[model samples]
Target: MSHRQVMKVLSGLLLGMFVAILSSTVVSTALPRIVADLGGGQSAYTWVVTASLLSMTASTPLWGKLADLAGKKVLVQSAIVIFVLASAGAGLAQSTGVLIAFRAVQGIGVGGLVALAQVILASIVPPRERGRYSGYFGATFAVATVGGPLLGGVITDTPGLGWRWCFYVGVPFAVIALAVLQRTLRLPAARRPDVRVDWLGALLVAASVCLLLVWVTLAGDSYAWASWQTAAMVGGSVLLGLLFVRVEARAADPVMPLWLFRNRTIALSALASLFVGVAMFGSTVFLSQYFQLARGESPTTAGVMTIPMIAGLFASSTVSGLVITRTGRWKAWLVAGGTLVTAGLGLLGTMRYDTAYWQLAVYMGLLGTGIGMMMQNLVLATQNQVSAEQLGAASSSVTFFRSLGGAVGVSALGAALSGRVSHYVEEGMAAAGIPQSGAAGGGAIPDLGSLPGPVRQVIESSYGHGIADVHLYAAPLALVALLLVLAVREVPLGRRAVGE
Candidate 1:
């Protein structure tokens, strides 16, 4: 295929990417309203993010391995259909639990889309020009990041329609993407007479993650972190994880090939992705809460306030992709990105409920720019190091680890935030001479507007500080990625692009 033909195929892939990314961010600003309407607290808010990431993380490797054994086109189209149906189901959810269940289902499709889009591209494009194409992917991501929040905010704030519309809105784009892909994508058949999937490995990994998440989400709030529940969950997770390693090492077709980690680049990239996930997902999930609960902004205003971050993401990804493609000197950008991300998160740590809007914007801009530079580039770097046959596994490996990091980050940070807010609210009640026993109905997540002046102030101040503190925890982890990037060896990219 010529360059024009390649671009034609990419059109459908880009649309699929757009719909997938759109589903995630659209819920960010709408989350508080969803929780309020569905009747839950911070745990529900955290689960909304965690459930998706958890499912995505667990399924990513399966999708990648399957793509290698089965065929890319059929797998990609199936993912699109699953996403569309899950979106419709999510739109009809009447309770937080049901919504969460649907979101988990949605995540399986999202995991497939995220991994396969990259796998398909890697199969078609040469390493040298991947940065350029990846830049387009990054641009698509930024567009979805920008639009999802803005559109979701608008829908949530509308007169009659609510946050449910955010889920419904992406269906048409996904359907069109499915239609376009069926016509344009041409790939050789991928089947092996002796092919086998490592189902035991997948089930063990999912079980371990589920048990661990249950522990992270419930530890402080529902029971003591040092109790028998912790012993059971933690011990079980460790056993299951080790069991998974054993299974992968012996399986004829492992979900995660153990040899891939023998490559220094893959090993370090996976490590960086893990830290990035913990820091990135854990810290950023609460920004809407900061704006709405702490600053008393509406969903629409909160969405608008986040524009600086998305703008930085767009600028950095677009520019870096072009630069890497032109010069083939990609290591500096990775180092620069890690530094900016660490610096950004560190700066954001100083913010509180009363921090000025301009200061917050600057900090968020730095974080987003750093992420844009680092995110796709790491996968590109890894893809450059692997054989053509290992492309899907290699691509999906990076994605799976990143999602893993996100799941842990959201759960651990959610625990930390919940604990911190409860303490602050308790102290505030005591200081204001309010009765401790019945304070705000035992610390239910209050509708800030519905509370009395003194009570509202206390809740706002608590959330403001709690949200800020989690960033401080995450900043050090991002710095760890910076150190890893500094040590990564840069490889020259191929000048000519290829296709299947």
Candidate 2:
């Protein structure tokens, strides 16, 4: 394909990517309001986010395997249709349970987009030239990450629109992407005469991930972390995971090929992606709450305040991609990005509700820059190592682990946040000689406007301290990602396609 042709197809692909990302991020700013409206507490808030991640994580590898067997274009279009339908359902949901169910279905489509986008790109673009195109992906991600919250915040704050519009806003963009993709995408068909999907492996993988995520989300709040329930859930998850590995090893067409892990670059990149997910998704998901709950900012104002982080992500991703394309070297950027992520998380750990906005901006910028440099490049590095035949499996495998990390991280961090906040609020109330039955009691998220000044201050401080602790816990994971990246061998990117 000519450069013009590639760009033409990429327009549709990036738009699809944009829609997928937008759907997830658009709800971040409005989640507080949505949960409160539905009469849910912290666990419900965490589950709302985790439901999608859990489903996306579980389905990613299956989508990738299917892409390798089926044609990419049809699969991409199918995913868009599923996403749009689910988004509509999510918008009309009257309860958190209904919304979560729709979000889970929406994740099945996201799994396709997230895996197939890179797989399709790898099919057309040579690794040496892929960096330039990846910059476009980074830009789309930045825009969606920036715009989703801002748009959601506006929609939520708007009197008539409410939080439901956050789900609806992405539908039109998706419809346009579907039309453009049909017109522009021209890929060689991928059909195997004896294609056999390992359905058992897929099921086992999904069951295992679901069990683990449920355990993590419910462990501290619903039951003691060391109780028999924990043992049962963890044991069940491990058994299912082992069964999945066994099933994959013997399956005709494994959803995730275990042999791929033998490749050094793919293994290290996958591992790095795992830790990156923990730090990136775990910490960033809560920033909206931090602004609204801790700092007492309105939703729209909170969204606007996140611009520095997005700006830094945009700059680093664009610049690093250009440099990598020119030089055909990517290891330095990975190392630098890892360093910055660790530093950023560490710095952010010191922040409280009363911390200066400038300090918060600086810290956020560093974290975003690091993520931008690392995220797509990890896939780029992994894709560079595999042949076209294995592109889907290898690409989605890394994404699966990353998403798995994110699900676990969010669940664990959220649980910790809930417990810490409750503890802090209790101490503050006691110190102030306030009753335990105040608005902040019962572990429910409080309405700041409804509380007295002293009580509100206590709630704010609790959230600030608890959130900071989450960042502190995540910093070590970023450091682990840095080590993994450093260990990755730098291979010179070739101009020719894989297996050429």
> In TM-score terms, which candidate is top?
2
Best by lDDT: 2
Q: Write the per-residue lDDT of candidate 1 for residues 379-451, one digit (tens) a residue.
A: 8888887776677788899999889989988988888888888888888888987766545422255687888
Q: What lDDT score is found at residue 395 in candidate 2?
A: 96
Q: What is candidate 2's CA lDDT for residue 110?
A: 92
- Which residue pairs in model 1 clash with each other? none
Question: Candidate 1 — which residues are off by over 4 angstroms?
Answer: 436-443, 496-500
lDDT of 1: 0.86
Candidate 2 lDDT tens digits, 160-226: 8999999999999999999999999988788996989888999999999899988988888889999
Candidate 2: list runs displaced more than 4 Å: none
TM-score of every candidate relative to the true structure: 0.97, 0.99
